[model samples]
Target chain A: MDYSGNGKQFSGKVVTVTSGKGGVGKTTLTANLAAALAADGQKVVCIDGDIGLRNLDVVLGLENRIVYDLVDVVEGRCRLRQAMIRDKRLPELYLIPAAQTRDKNAVSPSDMIRLTNELRPEMDWILIDSPAGIERGFRNAIAPADIVLVVTNPEVSAVRDADRIIGLIEAEEKGPARLVINRIKPAMVKRGEMLSMEDVLELLAIELIGLIPDDEGVVTSSNRGNPIAIEGKSKAAQSFRNIAQRLQGHKVPFLELQEDGNLFGRLARLLRPGGN
Target chain B: MHAVLIKPGTDRNGMEISTKFQIKGIREGLLVTLGDAPWEQVYAALIEHLDEQRDFLKGARLALDVGNHMLKAADLGQIRNQISERDLTLWAVISNSPTTERTAQTLGLETRLSKPKPEPAAQDTRYQDGDPAILVHRTLRSGYSLQNPGHVVILGDVNPGAEIISGGDVIVWGRLRGMVHAGAGGNESAVICALDLAPTQLRIAGVIAITPQRRGKSQPEMVRILNGQVVAEPWNPKKKD
Candidate 1:
């Protein structure tokens, strides 16, 4: 008795990117993952779940194309397809921008589940950018997720917050969330000034899905409203591409952080002059 | 000790009004008595009342007296789950039916309203017990708080941003890095202990302390207020402080 009338054989996997703390690159990871997935010819839609603080559109460079936002779709002011702003460069990518005026309570968890279900048939992946904190916004973002990617920096505070978020995810039974350690400065970690990948893993015991090194190009590309994963040549872009591959069940080896600043690594750096 | 009675009211058009459940504070948490009506109506009314008083009744233990109602195990289990989802523990089921009592017993609920047992000696602290204690088995996350007027014991890590406020001693079998306040009702002798004690903030009665930055690995530590100041020391059962 398959009573669900929406006769669709395929449904996209909903992945939510969330961090308990603000300024930890949740939006950046969502935008880049969407871009990388779309570049791989997968139809991806990114729903900005940060209501009233919507920036995924700006990060994805689809701000100007948003005629109707998520609030419109939930409020019955427009159709779900009408609010989907398709990416011009990547023909398979789309952005469902959050409403700037309404807050997180404007849409409930059931509403998000319905919206993602409606878009499930036509898409391959739905990436949601969750707002910071363990409140209504985070609940809404994770309600429809098949996988939750916890993005965190290699700092004590961020890792602590990520641990708390992981506990909450497990409490909601959406757990065993995969981890993404973003903005790792290898030089600082080598100097023992910053928390290393192992240190972060020791506290938050979760599977590591991606490790993106600190790159200045990410800032410039985000400023220009373009995701670095689209066509950038930085190691950060390659890391995102590897993450996308891993999401598609590809076994990609993690990038070596190159933290050994000894004579051997120094010689290698000197010979190549631009080694990561 | 007396049974509560309720009379149905009449509407403006002279229609009979449906009587709902009543909630009253008792020595043991709250006593919620269902009215003499259909099971569905009484259950719905009870849920509606609980929802309406949610803010005032969070984390309160409850004793449900479903008078003479011969409810099955499924019915009792469903109500218990609903009450737990509202953060209220249904500790006892005071029923007049032996069938209902057996059903409640199968669900691990007490069939009588006995006085809650006092917790055994916790760590090295003594207490003038008043409020009933609660034992939590899962990790407390950020934005999640456990506030009990009695003692609180946790079996998992208390991550940063989580909080526990208790009137008695606070004990953690795992790491404790969150904020905790023992002796919240001003019992200065209350103590806090954890396997790896490194809380963001710790309070005992009127004393407050922050964990100093550790340069070495963490160990099982206990914290208490000694002379108007909070201090932490390794918990060794063989040695005296």
Candidate 2:
């Protein structure tokens, strides 16, 4: 079967995006990162390793057109070219969708390795969207990742899961994983209702890459099958782009939207003066 | 080629087809390499070999190296099932092809023999390289045993049935409720500190200490080698200096 090598490179390296918790924006990051990288002229293919709960296709807006998936290619039922759903907007970007019917057991870690190894020769980056949980899906996604970006939010459960995932990653000899804190609510953080960046960092204690604030636009865009990162104006979009740029070896600054959530909230309150 | 390759009875030849397979211990586990021919022949030969030397290889960890025949999960699973039927654990299957490797992995088998990890931290500690320690930042789940020949600084909880073995010291930033072995390399100076130090059993150097039924208020405590014994004491900010 024609397994296309990773369509992007960094000093010719493929990086995979992963998270330990379910529904913690792994797909969102993978889709946006691929789009952002492709926008910068890097050939990228985001492989959704979350087979059963495959949402990369949906988030990337390639859901309706998916005919074959990673399992199909791995099982040799379809050619890899037949499975890769090229992005409508980006000429260089691609999406290797995951099968929605099958569970994580459908593909093995080595199948992913073979697939990624084949893709490594062709692409600039093979950004695999790892499924949540520190199980088989996680292993498959990380098996061939030259770099793993562990995504999390500023929440206790998410941070705990991230820590576990990081430990498992290190145990597998698969990390030195970088961190991406997603969907952090600045206002809640300030009032002590949410975990601040320091609180999350104290628990994770990893090199921070991107700080994406909570954006309602992400929901609307996903509903329209458009990833927010593809839209240039949105804040979350900018976050994904910066992450992609950093992955390309650019020294991008982490967004300092809020130093401590309370300060930002206090400033907002002062500016508003309780008019509404 | 098959006829010529086979040794006649027990006589001298290039390789003996009739010869019993050898099961010897390698660093990883029992290395069992089947002769290349048909899988049926190899399977039968392995069982026969096991039967003959049942006493010698009982309850041993095994790793089978099946050279380049793309085995599906069921094929590898069957081998493991057969091995388990004989009370042997098949821990790994070393393969050359990606397909075989995938199958082995799908069957939850190790792709490589467990090579002894280079004890970098341990080596660093032995040289007294500025309080060498390994830091962990996750919950140690059940059945997880971390053996560091240096100090261990954990940023999370150590659950029951988990173990931490350190040569120098062990510190849990979170609660510690596991079996811990400090002074693992027999160094008596090792100590263990935890937010709530209620361990199933704690050992330091040659001394073993039990938690005193955990009656009092929970506090950050340190267990150290005091008066030639391991003692648990309330951690004091002013005591160390």
Candidate 3:
């Protein structure tokens, strides 16, 4: 929350979280990853880039403290620091809520770039929660990122959209985007009703960053306006933590998808070129 | 946004009325050849044509043949962006001016038309090779379409929603799951072949066919018009006698 972290000499990195389809857990992943990174002693800020459909503040439980939002900052109605809502739980985490009244045209891609440039010298990570669909909103979110994480589900529709989004990212020269498969049900996959991880990876052909299981704890924590990464021991929470660690350049092995697959299975899969 | 200018000599309500631009169906999509006039006037005429033919031109890939027009980067970029807003993709720009060609290249636009021409004779004056086909080396994802006047050869996968239309034969060295049209200029003998032929739709001249569900594993298949009907057969090198 310190905007004046001068003399530290560490430039912050921008990471954009985007999904081509709606209701695909982009906001959940953003909130949890921001929380996990902050807990790991990295100063992080989450920018809600959904414009009129802003929900990052609500999910982060910082809705009540918002006096200014992204539109206010871009329109020069408030300073960058004045619009950032510092979290009450984690001292290092902050939230920049979006304006609920204006549409995506209220902000431009250059505005996001300039704002991130101003915040780059002070923080460790700047996370932008991109809106669904490939429009001006999506372009605004990705214009300022050093890395992009494309979130998708295991369904055919989600993978199809992810492929299109990946193609667009590559066209913009911002790819290859990393993939994070969320809300995966291992039981359904075993029953031949869902797409396996290998199927998704084969089609996407991108680096696999994280796999989040379907956990009811995510809904419960969201109802209470708290990310599970900050207060739970669920497998989903652990996966988000691992993603945060991977983002920090750590060599963390992927967690086994099956219930009985142990460390040896994971290690063997890693050793083989196309094992799983 | 201007009122369309119909060519003189035809009836006002006639469907055969001409404009300042000529649009012909090509393998790649629709090729729009502009008349030699002021660039601004030609651009305005083109927009009016697209607006008047919006229903017929929706979702069409367009290649502009701007002859001898020395265009700046900003001008070409603006036109490309405006074309996309109209639900049309301007992929190639054929120009005679080197400056214009360089500008189009800078914008990542294709500057060559698929025309069979002899390569610059390097070693022998009597030997020449005329291959009009272009070998694309990357996967064609959704929303991408390639059109050519000659044969088209692809070395990568063609994902769903991607399209390839060629005036001659079409061949894919990898998976072909998208739509394809060979002999788009009405050559009935044109053939379409793929390593794995599971196209959404296949067209040869006047014929159209959809792929059937496979019984087991995939195999190399060739599709062509046989006895006035589009049919597929397994491609076996040993069967060629």
What TM-score would chain A of each candidate receive against the reference chain A?
0.91, 0.89, 0.91
True contacts kept of each: 0.19, 0.00, 0.14
The Cα error of candidate 2 at residue A67, in Å, is 1.7
Q: Across residues A1-276, which tens digit of lDDT does each residue of candidate 1 receive?
A: 111123433878889999899998999999999999999999999999999999999988888887999999999999999999999999999999999999997887768989999999899889999999977798789888888999999998898889878876775567679999999888776656667787677667689999999999999999889999999998899999989998887888888767453422233333332201
lDDT string for model 3 (B1-241, tens) is: 2333333333244423243456767778777877676788778767876887788789999889988678887578567756765778898999989678756754557887664332222322211367467677777776566777777899988877788888778999988888998877777777899998888899987789987766556689999999999999999888766
Instruction: Name the lDDT value of residue B59 in candidate 1.
Output: 96
Note the DockQ of each predicted structure. 0.16, 0.06, 0.14
Which candidate achieves the best TM-score against the true structure? 3
- lDDT for position A11 in model 2: 31
| Residue pairs in candidate 1 whose N, alpha carbon or C atoms collide under 3 angstroms | none
By the TM-score metric, which is better: model 2 or model 3? 3
Single out the weakest 10-residue window by summed lDDT for candidate 1 chain A.
Answer: A267-276
Q: Kindly indicate the candidate among 1 and 2 with the higher TM-score.
A: 1
Q: Lowest lDDT 10-mer window, candidate 3 chain A?
A: A267-276
C-alpha TM-scores of all predictions? 0.70, 0.62, 0.74
Tens-digit per-residue lDDT, A50-164, candidate 2: 8999888888888899999999999999988888888879988999999999988788776787887787767777889898886668777887877888899888777767876
- State each candidate's clash count: 0, 16, 3
